[model samples]
Target: MRIKETIYKWIFTIFAFASLLFLVGIVVVLFKEGLPIFKHVKLVAFLFGKSWYPTYEPAEYGILPLIMGSVWVTVGAVLVSVPLGVGSALYLDELASYKQKAILKPIIEILASIPSIVFGFFGMVIVAPLIQRIFKLPVGLCALTASIILGVMAIPTICSLAEDALSYVPRSFREASFALGANRWQTLTKVVVPAAGSGVSTSIILGVSRIVGETMTVLMVSGGAAMIPVSFFQPVRPMTATIAAEMGEAAMGSAHYHALFAIGLILFLVTLVFNIIAELISRRFRIKLGLNR
Candidate 1:
């Protein structure tokens, strides 16, 4: 037994270290390839300049439009996904009948398993035309269409994690609130939900990470316009979309190739920040809930 334990520990330790090594190697390569773009353009200009004509004469390389496109789509996705996801979680965890849970939960899980490319087709073939008709727009492919599709993609993640969070709230909390004469709604709102705040927040943040990093769906439905977005109806290209669309065609060792790597670096850092924030929130919640000392 002692020998087995020691072997297991060493095996897991090696795996953990191997994963860390790969992460570090990726960071080093990203920096080595991406840092060259800074030599060609100032950091401020690269970040804030609006133009993104990498193949034009003199080749502009500002990424502000790309950044804003990502922000707009992400924000729109959050708006669409968060409320619906939370509501779904509340229903499944607090209000649903066993039969409903049996039916709906599996359906949602299946929804999550569907491929991104399939979702892209749905957006293009169905949602886009519907949106265009409702808004009387000339084109169906726009930020709004992309955002709605991404939001749908994010829903299963947010709903599952949030439902799990709600399930973790101690039954004693609800009973205590009831003993104090609180109604079901009151207990749910002021007791159970608050107890699960960190988990719900983590879910939302993770959903946002998915929304921002999405490539294929956004590339297909976001109209492929590399311009600053003024309206939700405008066509815009996010950083992920731009990278997915152009990286193959960019010449190796050229400025464009380096710029794509730079975009990836920024995206990596952004997702890293979201993950860190989620960890901090989850840790704080665990401490508050007395799950950790």
Candidate 2:
């Protein structure tokens, strides 16, 4: 028993060390590639300048359009997914019958398990054409279309994580609310939901990370237009899509290639900040729940 326990501990420690090394490796590579953008382009020009015509003779490196497009698509996706995902989670956690949960949980998990490429294909074939036909637009591949696909993809993750969080709330808490004459809905909204707020927030943050990192789906549906999106119906190119579409063709060691890495660096930093914020919020929520004690 002691030998087996020692072996398991060593294996777990090695896995953790490997994960840390992988993350450090990514950070080092991104920084090395991203730092060169300041050589030919001013920091402000790269960060805030609106134009993104990298193919121009002078090779403009303005990343604002891509940044704006990424933000727009991610926000749109979250707007569509958050309420629905949270509501579905609440339903599954607090109200669903055992049989219903048995059916619904697997369905939600299956949705998440579906490959992202398959989702992209579905968006390209079905959602885009529908939008184009309904709106009489030139093409349905746009920020809105991408948002809808990303929203669908995020739903399963948010729902599953949020449901797990809600499930962790003690039954005594619900019983106390019920004993106080609160209805099931009131108990859920005021007590259980608040108790699980940290977990739900964590889910949202995770979903944000997933949305930001998504490359193929956004590339397929976002029309690959490297311009600032004035409206959801207009074509836009997210940072991930730009990287995916251009990385293959960008000449190695060129300014354009470095700029793409810079975009990735920005995305990674933003997601890291959100993750840190989520961790802080989660800790605070645990204290509120008296679980930190």
Candidate 3:
């Protein structure tokens, strides 16, 4: 039994090390490929440049439009998902009957299992046309459409994570609140939610990261226009969408190729920051709750 345990430990350690190595390799490759854009385009200019005419001579490599588009779409997705997700989690944990939770949880889990391409197709076929009609826009495929789709996709993740967090709160806390003459709403708001705040925040951060990395759904519904979107109705392209849309057409080792990798590096760093922030906040919350011992 001791030998078997040692073998299992070795297997887990090897797998963890392998995963870390794989991530480091990808980051190294991305930075190496991306650093060249700074050779021709100044770092400030490359980041803040409004135009992205990479095909033209004296190739423009301004990534501001893409960055802005990514921000707008991600914010929209978060706006749509966070409230709905948190509300669902609250109901599941605080209000819903066991039978209701049983029905809804499976439905939400099923949503997570659906392929992204299918969501893309649904956005293209159903959402795009509706937006065009209502907004009278030139194209239905825009940041708003992509945001709506991504928001729906992020729901299951946020809801599940937040529910788990709420569940982790001690039952004694709830009973103490009740003993103090607190009503359900008061207990939930003053005790339960505060206790689970870190979990809720972590869920939101994870949802943002998931939407940031999404490619195909954004590409299929975002009109793939690499321009600064002044309005939600206008077409825009996010970094992930640009990489996916142009990867097949861009020549290997070309400037455009490097630019794409640069965008990828930016995304990687952004997600890493979010993850770190989430972990830090979670730890702080645990300490405040006296649960870190």
lDDT of 1: 0.94
The alpha-carbon RMSD values of the candidates against the true structure, listed in the order shown, are 2.2, 2.7, 2.5
- Number of the top lDDT candidate: 1
Across residues 1-293, which tens digit of lDDT does each residue of candidate 1 receive?
99999999999999999999998999999999999999889999999998999998899999999999999999999999999999999999889999999898888878878889999999999999999999999999999999999998999989988888888898999999999999999999999999999989998998899889999999999998999999999998999999999999999999999999999999999999999999899888888878885
Stretches > 4 Å off in candidate 1: 1-16
lDDT of 2 by residue, 19-51 (tens): 999989999999999889789899999999999
Backbone clash count, each prediction separately: 0, 0, 0
- Ranked by lDDT from best down, the candidates are 1, 2, 3
> Which pairs clash (backbone N, Cα, C closer than 3 Å) in model 3?
none
Q: How close is candidate 2 to the true structure, as a TM-score?
A: 0.92
Alpha-carbon deviation at 26 in model 1, angstroms: 1.5
Order the candidates by TM-score, highest first — what do you get? 1, 2, 3
The whole-model lDDT of each prediction reads 0.94, 0.91, 0.90
- Count steric clashes of candidate 1: 0
Looking at model 1, report the run of 10 residues with the lowest lDDT sum: 284-293
Residue-level lDDT for 7 in candidate 3? 100
Candidate 1 clashing pairs?
A: none
